[model samples]
Target: MTIQSDRARDALLDAAEELFARNGIDAVSNRRIVEHAGAANHSAIAYHFGGREGLLRALVERHHDEMARRRRELTEQLGETPNIHELVTTRLRPLIELLDSLPKPSWRAQFMSQISAVPSAVEVAKEVIGDADLPDDLRFINGAVDGIPEGVLRGRAYLLGSMVVGVCADQEAKMNEDANKGSWEQVGRFLIDAAAGMLGAPVTDPDGAVRYPSVPLL
Candidate 1:
């Protein structure tokens, strides 16, 4: 792509992310995105990213390499057998760091939270993430955790993602209101502790019968 087209594409992504974060994703129209981006062509989004689905995929893919690299660095620091806390940090800290690195008033976290609720958008993000293959650190973390029912583990994993995104979005919004809400490092630490606790918690059936089945650490 030429430099000019690349600039337009980035501008569109920026405008879309802000609009989607402030307003509901479904509430923002393509025309508005083009207007916000100040692109001369009304079809810039379609021309650059195909459509809304492609745009969302591009948004997710935008940070994939950096996040993956950060995770990889954390994973490399792990001992042969890392504990749940270390595993949780490896899985989540990159996101917090990414948020920290962004300019003030970032919408990436809120955009992710919004997309998490849209099934098609979530699928698009998963496609960008290539969910078919689990990362080695993730696979190791999943295998290391024992004595939890597979079902419970899976449920907690899903909840963990929701919690992280929700909390980060909330915190980001709060920071916009008052910068004293807290630092991203604090958020990261709290999330790591909370995730470690949730994943390591004992699993019990409705009747309170303890169950032991392995769960993935996604």
Candidate 2:
């Protein structure tokens, strides 16, 4: 694509990200996204992203790349047999870093959180992320949670993912509203601690027996 075309595509993506973050995905219209992009063509979104789902998928793909890369880097830094806290921190650090790096308040974190909370949007995000490189931290974290039953593991994973997204979304909103500085670090550490505890928690048997982890909690 030419310079102008590329700019138009980016503008559409940027506009959609902000609009979806603020007003929600279903509430925003294609015409509105195009207008927000300041493009004369009303079909800019359709032309660039096919539709809302496609646009959201693109945004998720981009964000996942950054998050995955950061996770991979953190995992590589470990000496071996990394602690659960470190493993969990890999999940929180990327977005916190991204939030810190942004020059102005961005709707990207809120956008991702909104999509993640929705089943359909999550499916789209999963499809996009599935195609990208999976991080080693995934394996590390799974191994750490091996003591839990498969059903419980799945539940905890869902809760943990939702919590991270929800917390980050709240933090993003706070930063936008109050210009809070360096506030993410404390929350990031708190999430790390909470996730590590949840993942490492003892498993109770269906027969009313509780089996605690042999490893001590942080």
lDDT of 2 at 48: 84
State the lDDT at 68 in candidate 2: 70
Tens-digit per-residue lDDT, 6-124, candidate 1 = 89899999999999998968889999999999998998889999988888878878787898898889989989988889988988988999999998888888888888666777677
- Residue-level lDDT for 101 in candidate 1: 93
- Candidate 2 has an lDDT of 0.71
lDDT agreement with native, every candidate: 0.79, 0.71
Estimate, for each residue in 55-156, the C-alpha lDDT of model 2 and write its tens digit. 877877665667778877987887667777887777678877877676566787788766854667767766776522323334556666666554454456
Q: Best by lDDT, which number?
A: 1
TM-score of each: 0.89, 0.83
Looking at model 2, which ten-residue stretch has the lowest summed lDDT?
209-218
Query: Which sections of candidate 2 miss by over 4 Å?
Result: 131-139, 179-182, 205-218
